[model samples]
Target chain A: MRLVLLIFSFCDWLQRTPVASYMRASFWAFPLVESLHILCGNVPLLVATSILSARLAGWGLREVPVSKLARGLLPWAWTGFLIQVITGLLLFSSAAAKYASTRIFPLKMLLILLAGTNALIFMRTTYRRVAAWDTAEVPPLGARFAGVVSLLLWSSVLVMGRVLNSAVSLVVAAHLWFAR
Target chain B: MPDFLSWCQWLESTPMSATLRDSLWLFPAIETVHLFGIVALVGSTSILDLRLMGFTLAGTPVPKLARRVLPWAWLGFGIQAATGFFLFAAEASRVYLNPAFRFKMLMLVAAGLNALLFHVMTSRSAAQWEGRSTTPMSAKIAGLSSLALWFAIVIAGRMIAYFE
Candidate 1:
């Protein structure tokens, strides 16, 4: 597995992003909304990073606790997710007809799945108890664990998103270069 | 700019990146890891920053909160530095030629330097910071800059695909 991954990276590394090949610069909506998608997707990312980083540093959620902040931030994060999913789909639609065959596409979907499933688990199991944490004062093994997992999963998703996009861009550029 | 395209073609044809590109999935995988680190860096620091900026928790020492999140942020930076270069190496001249790419690199430098200034000039004293958590002006400036820079980087990164 490591060997295969290494080979792929090497190939990918050799391939440039071809950053300017097919850009029409004519469309407004696609670029506008893609900007939004990228922005919004970052919301959950920021919150999750904070909660988890707090844990990694031994602060746990006790200082802020979990239930309140999680609940408060949940809507914003979900809003971001919704934007990402919707806009992400549109962005994909712009290129979808051929993106299906790429390896990075599968990786992107899998990372999203990992993040979503893990997030669901977080919302369902540990978050329910967040309200009771400050007063109840539990040691936070569960929330800590959840936060750590959230960080790891989200991070993977972020990387996958980038790699997927980069690889896809490379493929598109290659196609254009060849067609030219 | 035809010269630039020729340069990219030449760069891609070279045995160095070709061998590495064909041989190293480690680059992407580490990049994957770096993404996680970056999210953590943003997430961890923002939580504290938000608190300092009057968003999340109230009444905690600002310095203490900063202390807690700071290490994680640094760790995130470390991971980012490692994998970020590989992402660049995959296509340096390509990114190097784009305006958006240049801006992103500038933002990266600005963000890093801003972070340093915040720590050096504006960090709250240990006494005022740890318990009642009042963020110094410099820290807030750093946080806002950091936020803007990272977001810009992400946008530019995404825009790299769309750039002409």
Candidate 2:
């Protein structure tokens, strides 16, 4: 209950802030911000997951050790993940109550959390043993599992994002009909 | 040109377009698929471009990386093209006239040309620098151009909604 109250107060405060109003009122701000968010947010996730998964599956990157590839690619992934959070929060703040009501919104957050947890686990467990199979064509079972999980979770997050739009529109339409 | 736009208007008025425009689920669902294609296409191209630019995966041969990644890139482009057609068909008139849409189409053309020129000019002799730490200047230029053009296409694509 306290958590819910804290959320409500935080959202209320966010809605009253200057940034939220500006985002909502501006004609191009929302779409442009959303563009940046999706591009920066999902692209890295896709790229990192795809390449890492391929490396894990022994599909490519045979010459370079897996550790080197991961090291090189992870900075971009981190950059993207950070951008997503910032832009996503701004977008959400512009319509907090509306977004909070949408089912897909929570699912999207959950997916992101799951993806993050999966990455952390991978880093801690399979990735710690990188020296053993760094150049092996097929990575060990755990690393492969983490790669696949990351891919699936991120993909679902994309789907959830798209669905959020539909869910919001449906809710709005229903509200209009009921009010009439 | 008027005739072409008129044809677009006609296309937009079709039942299929109605479903895409009016049905909330269908539009976003198709758009999600479109995003998937973008991820696949752009994601793959970006990696290959980075490799060409001598940024990452230095141990992997250029030709080998290209051979692995380009197919996925092409597949993504193909998916985008198919889904894009459906999307354009749904809002043909609006998209036909939108400046952002026009910009996106132009950038896509530029991207295509850049890819083709790279393939014909630079990539033909990829074997010479395949394992080298640094690529030739021409390869670097092509890689840089590809990176810039594809990202421009992405920005232009996202602007379509705001402009419309």
Best of the candidates, TM-score: 2
For candidate 2, lDDT tens digit of each residue in B18-120?
8888885677888899999988998889888888888877777888878888898989999999999988998898899999899989988998998898888
Interface RMSD of each: 3.7, 1.5
In model 2, the runs with Cα more than 4 Å from the true position are A57-64, A169-180
Alpha-carbon lDDT of model 2? 0.84
The candidate maximizing lDDT is: 2
lDDT for predicted candidate 1 compared with the true structure: 0.63
Off by over 4 Å in 1: A1-39, A46-69, A99-171, A174-178, B1-16, B22-31, B124-126, B133-142, B160-164
lDDT of each: 0.63, 0.84
DockQ of each: 0.24, 0.66
**lDDT string, candidate 1, B1-164, tens digits:** 36766676677667765654775465567555655665666666666657756655566566766776788778877877767665666676776787877887888888778767766764445555655545656666666767777777767765664676
Please report, as a residue range, the 10-residue window in candidate 1 chain A with the lowest summed lDDT.
A15-24
Angstrom error at residue A153, model 1? 5.5
